[model samples]
Target chain A: MKLSLGPLLYFWERDVVQSFYQSISKSPVDIVYLGEAVCSKRRNLKLDDWLIIADMLDAAGKEVVLTSLALFEAESELGLLKRICGNGRYPVEANDMAAVSLLEDQSPFIVGPHINTYNPSTLALLSESGARRWVMPVELGGETLKQLQQARPDNIETEVFVYGRLPLAFSARCYTARAQNLPKDHCQFCCASYPDGLLLKTRDARSFLTLNGIQTQSASIYNLIYQVPELVSLGVDVLRISPQSEGTLETIDAFYHAMHSEVNGNRKPIEDWQIVDYEFCNGYWYGQEGMLWKRTDEYKNLESALNR
Target chain B: MAITPVGMKRITPELVCPAGSLPALKSAVENGADCVYIGFRDGTNARNFPGLNFSTDEARQAVDYAHDANAKLFLALNTYPKPDQWQAGVRAIDLAAQLKVDALIVADPGLMRYASQNYPELRLHLSVQGSATNHLALDYYKRHFNIQRAVLPRVLSLSQVRRVALEAPVEIEVFGFGSLCIMVEGRCALSSYVTGKSPNASGVCSPAEAVRWEKQGDHLCSRLNGVLIDEFSEHEQAGYPTLCKGRYRVNDSVYYALEEPTSLNVLEILPELMQIGVSAIKVEGRQRSPAYVAGVTRTLRSAIDACINNPEEYQVQPSWMRDLDKVAEGQCHTLGAYHRPWQ
Candidate 1:
């Protein structure tokens, strides 16, 4: 399975974003998704800036895809979506139906994870509407994906979000600004301070969620590194790794090594698991509570045999 | 209802209300609801709460009662179904079509395709859970499923709503009152992240089973699955522990980081909504009591009538406002995204 880099879901400085992609040019990831998928007010990287980065990544033998915002509220946002769809070079990942509508019958595109493709017929509709690849919604489990694979249209690739904090929701109200006692219009670029999003804890001080501008993400980082074998066996064509503020290159290397190791018949269990600075969760894939981390086989085998 | 004056014309928008049970459906129709939307008890709809919604028998009777009262009945099969549950959604659609309900409010494109292909004559209204905020999104549904109407998500500004209505190929429905969803419906996974259930996958948010309330040092702490959602002081009133309405520490201060516990009341915008060609005004709260549904339906009914009869003299009466406020969440209301400052 090929590894793809998802669009940046957080606001970052233009230079920081530029250097991040500059480092990614030498990474093993095959497809790179560019552009902002969260709040549209984050204009640190305009369409022109994204195109410049796309050219840099393209020259490095990486496929590039532009991503549209998850929530479309203004005419200006829709106008931006039109420009991205008509960019002529890279295929756009349609995050919302508005994007899908604009790209319909034009050329093949990628359906972003935000679009609900829960069943086969929806997948079929999208495939018929010129979608060449579809990212499974993050909330769906492995069993659901397995079932969808039976009826998935031919030549359409299935991608899954295998890493990073799961994007839980998007709203018109900016939670980051609201946390600072400011309205959305007066957010004052407060989200730029949170390179990986602001952590939210319960009254008992248990980490629960992350608040980035308009997007709310899971506090527990989603890691399916241990399940790469199962995902590959289930006919998944692409594994998407969302970008984080730190250790993204290491995270991508870990996943890339796991994919190759499994194929080379010398599978190395993921040890030294401090790849990112968050607790790991794979419950959504296990069809359990999304925050719970079910034990992987390596840990299960190390425990009592009866525990299995 | 339509009112014609000389060369000018105005179509009184439909007063669509929610009914989670047979009693709620009856109360809404009795209280002047032009149309009532309901869900089956089988977890196929967004309001899939335990002990709520209509059984097959209950749904058949609901259709008869609404037809008898000259009020329309719309069945809500709005949630996206997984592969195992896909057949259940199709069965619910078949049952609703067989009962001859006025329309089917749906979100999933697969289900919409199935319903349109199998039951060719049934009317389909795109549910708010469809999250069609722009004209292009609405056109996607209209072109594919031949939907008759589309409920706009609550995320749109008033001018955006007007612009969409002008360019929309289908009739537009806007939320007039209900518990405010800070996030767009069908797209939010906060519930699933915390409690393993979501409106898109399981048709519930902040499910009741995951909720627990405790009194700690004179403050009431509401927890969902051992994660505290909010803590209310002795004098402060506590609303439902929806994650968005919960207090969280942001930038070193605790506050309702997403939204305060409140209901969206658009009675003041009824005239503006009608002028912008809004075909229906929906009163949310299927999980609420029959009395709540009746009060909201009656108040919005009167508000729409006044706005239609005399647009120049239309004023939100204090009595109507008080009646709605009594049933509002957090006992507060806002114009929500209809007003620019709230966004």
Candidate 2:
């Protein structure tokens, strides 16, 4: 399986974003997704800036894709979407149907995870519209991915989100602004201070969610390094790693090594893996509550014991 | 039901209402609903609550009753079905086709294709679950399946709604009143994150099975799957536990970080909606009772009529607002995204 870097979902300083991509050009990720996929108000990087980074990554032998905004509520956003679709050098990852419609009949595009692709017919229809690859929705489980794999059209690749905080929802109201008692219009770009998003805890002090500008994400890091073998068995073409403020390169390296180990058929023990030190959850892969963590080995051992 | 003449020729906005049961359907039709939308008794629709929705026999009765009163009955096959339950959605579409329901409100593109191909004559209205906030997205469906109408998601402001209505290929529908969804429908997964059930897949949010209530001293606490949603004081009202509307700790403060539990009411902006060429106004409460549906539908029906009769001299009656406030969630209402500052 190939490793791909998802679009940066957080807002950062222009220099920080540029330097991050500069380092990413030398990384092991085979594909790089660039552009703002979260809020349109985040203007630290424009289309021109993304294209310059795309050119650098292209020179570094990396395939680059421009991702559109997940939600568009203004004409300016749609105008930006049109420019991204006509970027002329890279394929656009259509996060919403507006991007899909704009990219249709023009070139092969990617259907981003935000677009609903639960069933086979939706996959087929997107394929018919010249979709080259489709990312699985973050909340869908491995079982659904397996079924979709069986029914996917020819030449359409399947990509699954394998790492980073899962983006759970988007809203018109900005929770980052609301947290500071500010309205969305006059948010003053306060979310810029939170490079990894502000953590929101339940009243009981349990970390429940992370409040990005207009997006809510899982507080737990969704790591599936142990499930790489299962993902390979399911015929997943690419594994997507969402970029974070810190230690994303290390996470990418861990996934790269994990993918190589699975390819060599010499699955190493969990202790030998250079995994990041973070609370991990794979419950969505196991079809349980997304916040719950279930070990694959536990289920395997239970099955073996039952058989014996 | 009368179309007042705007600048040129413009169709009067229809008052589309919701019905969880046959009585609600009848009440909606009798109270001046131009159309009534419902779902099956199973998970084919968004409001998959216990003892709610309609069986086929009841659905047949609903169709007859709505048609007799010159109101259309629509079936909502809105949820995205996974492979395990894909056949259930197809079966629901087949049933809608067989019943000759006036329209089938759909969200899934795959299911939209199925309904469009198998039953070419069946009218299609894109459900709010589809989350088409712009005209380009609406055009995609209109170009592919020839959808007659598309319900705009609640994410768009009034000006954005007008921009879409000006360029959209199909008729437009906007939610006028109901419990508000802070996030875009069909795109949210916060419910599944906590309860393992989602409106997209299971057609329910905060499913009843995952909900637990406990009283601690004088405070009443409501929990969903062992997660404390809120703690209500002795005199405070404890609203239904939805993840978005619940109080949570953001930074150092604990409050309704996403939104407070309040219903969305657009009675104050009926003229603006009609002026934007919106074809329909929807009152959203399929899980509510018949009396709730009747009261909301009656007020909205009169409001729409009054707005049409004299677009230049129309005012939202104080009594209309009072009637709606009686059934509003938390006994409070906001204009939601329609008012730009609410964002």
Real contacts recovered, all predictions: 0.78, 0.91
- RMSD after Cα superposition, model 1: 3.0
Q: TM-score of predicted model 2?
A: 0.96
Clashing pairs in 1: none
Writing each residue's lDDT as its tens digit, candidate 1 over B167-263 gives 7778889999999987888899888877889999999999999999999999999988878899989888888898788987665667776788999
Please give each candidate's TM-score.
0.96, 0.96
Candidate 2 residue lDDT tens string, A53-86:
8999999999999999999899999999999999
**CAPRI level of candidate 2:** high
- C-alpha lDDT (0 to 100) for residue A25 of candidate 2: 89
How many clashing pairs per prediction, in order?
Answer: 0, 0
On the 0 to 100 scale, the lDDT of residue A68 in model 2 is 93
